[model samples]
Target: MRRLLSAVAMLILLTSACGEDTLAAGTYDGPLAAEGRQGAAHRVVECDDAPTGGNNYPGEYDNGALSDEPEAALRTAFDEAQITGVHDGYVLVREDDDRALFTFTDAGRVRQALIVHDGEAFGKEGWYVESWARCDYAELPAAVAERAGVEIWFDADGPVSTRRVHSADGPEHCGWQHLTFLSLGETTYVRDADTEYAEWTDAPYDSEADLPPHAVDTGFHRDGDHLWRSPDGTRAYVGNREKVAVWPRTKDGFTCA
Candidate 1:
């Protein structure tokens, strides 16, 4: 009985250590916020879509390819780039002279990866999306329009739940941030704060930040496609061309848990 209990205790200890190793510090991709950037690794290739020669800073770039086995690519790239000490949620991959942060799922799949520009740290603004290549072990996956029982379409048109504002408030025509994506029945909408941040601030309604947090709940007109403050109000995307903004549910909606 004593030997059996010892064996069980050893198994439990191994499991706990494995779990701790897999999960990094933070909840989502924000791991480095607490742990800080690691060693002297740097990025070599730019992660942008447009092609550039070498070692340039402050230019527009495109997002990288979605991968099921992004962790594998990080390892292979590490041989040349030397990325080390990756937590399960996020990893910093460094080239000889450049660095990028790769955010992964708990399962170790790649969610998104971005290049941190020169002079910028891991968590700040200069992180441009990386250019991902399809590996033999995993192919770049498609952007899911629907997940967790919710349907989503971009640049879509038709009668979506909407409301409007007087010119004094906003563009005079904005959908209730939540209604921008046409949903049905009990399907709930969730926002990935890292990806869809404009939903939380008034910055989108007025890029100049001139408005005083005005509410648009009056005029009503629905003509074409639309863009509204993302459900949170972080940034503004294009929304309906109608008059009134009709909110189907409550505003101050839920952010992804």
Candidate 2:
């Protein structure tokens, strides 16, 4: 919990891995793809406005059924420096971290956690948006806002339905490449048994590959190598990490089995 990065940066991330065609064959335009499809994660967002989800916390499976399954849709994608460097001209800058922490238990469904900084004018970028659970925090798409290149404020549509995610810090569960969290719904996946990936071309690159299902699954959990549940296990994406990324129920989207 306090090792952050070492061993020669984990041997330069196992001699560098996570090759999705070197960050998904880049391309973006028009207001940075309209802030990569409506950018957000939080900006003084405070919602307890009272939706009051049913009090059946006991195996609470009535109607919502893992909250409109699809592995529990929640999405955001972008990488290649905020889609070709700050909307093509660079003016991007995200700031907000008053000690980032936005949990969900009163029916927010484990969402929004920040530590942002996606700058511009000349150059600036930094990230840390752990658990960006989204039900639709205002639009969101554009490759799920560049997979965490940085700059977000989506609240995931107020009161999250099933599962959602947003964590950053690749390399160390298998060095490099891993930042697409929307565990179950609206397409957000990457967990072929804790992703020991070394290949999967059509984007995301460096070299070596073999794990591609794209997005969607509804049940997964593993704990020793930290690959938490909630794609449809009811909230708990990527526990303590040893290998985490989900979407494995049996059937869903992202095209895997």
Give me the candidate number with maximum lDDT: 1
Which residue ranges in model 2 land beyond 4 Å of their true spot? 1-138, 141-144, 147-182, 185-190, 194-257
The lDDT values for all models are 0.27, 0.26
- lDDT of candidate 1? 0.27
Model 2 Cα lDDT, one tens digit per residue, 146-241: 543422322424323223433333334444444333334343434332333323311222122222333223233222323334424432234333
Please provide TM-scores, in order, for all candidate models, with all chains considered together.
Answer: 0.22, 0.19
Candidate 1 local lDDT, 111-143, one digit each (tens): 233333322323323322233321111111112
RMSD of each: 17.9, 21.0
Best by TM-score: 1
Candidate 2, RMSD to the unseen true structure: 21.0
Model 1 stretches with alpha carbons more than 4 Å out = 1-58, 61-88, 119-173, 178-180, 183-257
